[model samples]
Target: MIQTLPLALPGALVDTHRIDLSALYSTGWGVEAHDVAVAPNGEVYALYGVHRYTHGVADDEADPATANLGYRIITRYAADGEVLASAVCCPSDGDGDDSAVVNGGEMTLCVLPDGTLAISARPDCTTLVAPDLGQVLAAYDSNDRRPFEKFTPGDAFASSISVTPSGRLLCVTTEYGVWKYGNTLANVVGVADGPLTPASKPVIEAIASLDPAPTRYGEDDRRDHVRYQGDPVGFDHRPRPALTERLAGEDRLAGWRDSRLGRPVPLADDLFVLPVYGRTFRGGSRGRPFVFALVDDQGAMTGRLGGMDAWDDSPFTGFCFNVASDPHRGRAFHLNRYGLYAWDSSGTLRARLGTDTKTFKPLSRFTLATCSPAGELLLVHTTQHLVLRVPTPDDLADLAPAVEQALRTYARQRTALKSRWSPVNWHWTHTTTVHHL
Candidate 1:
């Protein structure tokens, strides 16, 4: 049921497709990418699908928990059509054996200003692989290094993540409105500019807290690690997000048990752009309009950016992926099933790309898009196992933050041990950490 809706355009957008995925696409395999990002040198990278387990064992739940493995395959394509890097993801069976898995889906990803990829992977409850429940936020840096850190949010299902210019992380999760995390992934109540207060004081106490500490993980948590039969693993793939069960008579709160937010972007000194998605049937659903909101460093609502209904078309159901913001251009870009949309920092609509049916044929539940500085829009239609390109708006800023080249600085740490003088015969050991030079 693909419907073509008439869309207004500048006559500059020319859509084309590429089918040679170099084995990234095949029959019976599903693909998903929140956005396919283009690098400064024209390299394109994305978090794509890989078979759950090649060998060992299979459970009814394994079929659905593909994304839980983290960025199983960080696929990189050269501007000239070649596979650049084949980075590994997380694990599947007890044996490091993954020829393939059936019925896996797509994933959401964003690149840091320094070229690190941050992914939010929610385990599928239907395919109960492990009983222990939690969500994994994995980071992969530019050099194709292993996941440096896996931040587990005990109660929140992270939907999308973005990094600020100063190196802090920002994201939108299921239960909470929006959150900011430092490089260490610690939840912060404020930014460098000022202290942030909760929009609702009462709601602050009401919401379940972010996991004080990440779930314990071993060094081999990467997806490509070896496994075997009877290896220790969780059988429950079901999600166990903290639910807001009952609210005391606040109609403004409505029935929102968990607010499903889109990508959070830190735009200026204190202003940040937050894309608020409609949470129906647990988010990533269809025909729901996106409400754009603005907040200051204090996490207070400064104003409403308005809904993404500038065209006044149907409700936007497909979630926005790799949402790009151009502070220099004073605008941002969002791609969903409805089409590619350009809006100002104030959430004002500048243009509409197309509709779900008119854009391209979708094979999976999600679609991904990113822009090129050379007046090209590089997109990956995961469902169709294809790469696409279109002309960019003449005035659109190359605010492809993820794609820009950044001179990176890696932090080094020094560890030391301290011993407390024994009072009688008992000695206390303490570990001290020194950061930076």
Candidate 2:
């Protein structure tokens, strides 16, 4: 059952419904949705993909067509849970070729400050397609059938995309480096040869030069200096042994490891980059993945900075599928298995919110999160229901007393459990003896 909890004001609450999507579509069809965003007018849009899944049947069951194909779906919804628009972003089987897999549509969409929508798409296996402002918006409104500009020379996977305040669009993928689109998408699309610029070079050398090299010395090496305690050469100093040689081997190993790890690189004026460990299923492990730093335009990297770890080593950490700037706090917020972690404008971690474990509790397990233009929080929870107009700072503060009372109740329960099960208590021992009989 779905539950609704009221939050304190300046907050508006809305009820959510879990539509049984499986029944809405035909069998053998699969759907997965991601990259949800809310517009200034509170309209929500999401990118989804449809595929084929095989289900087992009994001997008596009727035979059915088993071939599976894939396509993409784009859906838009009003604030009041009304379906405003729906379109097939990519028609996978349009060519009627069974051997070829058709992957279409945009993986990432960004709404510019001027109310224009930008989509990053890979129309085929070997090209990157991004339509300009005029083209993108026209496609969104279904005014144009073709809106993508293809970069022919270089192939890229459209994994992620973002638009800067100045109107530059950055398209990125895990396998390929980043590409920049100028003020208009036309400039990049017109050049069919390849990326307008070459892939960014790794800045390993600059980071290595920032530190000084250590001097080498032997364990028995010693030095003596004349000391003038009262007068010139009045006091003589004994030779002191140098400690550098003793730690030379360890220091050299450490330096080598540090060098191999590489240093963080700056993507934009505020954004920085680092390499994070990624997941591996086989016995062998893959190299570390890249982590991008998200920062605000006015923020300085010297202080405020928040980072995204591609594959975090910490057991508590999980994959971050989406990240966005919170308009209310001016911080970058990301969704992870451990909940939402907030980072300042310069890409530094500010705070981590929500429960430690995944649960159906309110304000936890956010699959998709976005801050609307009006500064409201919209979350598509793990339950697959859209939650709109959640509480903000003032609303949380207003409910502080009630929230504290609930926490106190939880604390008391924990204390009672400890008292009942503690090894120091004799009752537990007595109970155990009775059970043995």
Cα lDDT of candidate 1 equals 0.35
**What tens digits encode model 1's per-residue C-alpha lDDT throughout 278-308?**
3355643454434555665544555655445
Question: What is candidate 1's CA lDDT for residue 82?
Answer: 46
lDDT of 2 by residue, 307-385 (tens): 4333342212333345555434444544555445555555666555545533323344445345554544455544333
The residue ranges of model 1 lying beyond 4 angstroms of the native Cα positions read 1-29, 52-71, 79-81, 94-108, 116-160, 164-168, 171-255, 282-289, 310-322, 356-366, 371-377, 389-391, 394-437
Could you say which candidate leads in TM-score?
1
Clashes of 1: 31
Clashing pairs in 2: 153-193, 304-346, 304-347, 305-346, 305-347, 305-348, 306-347, 306-348
Question: TM-score of predicted model 2?
Answer: 0.47
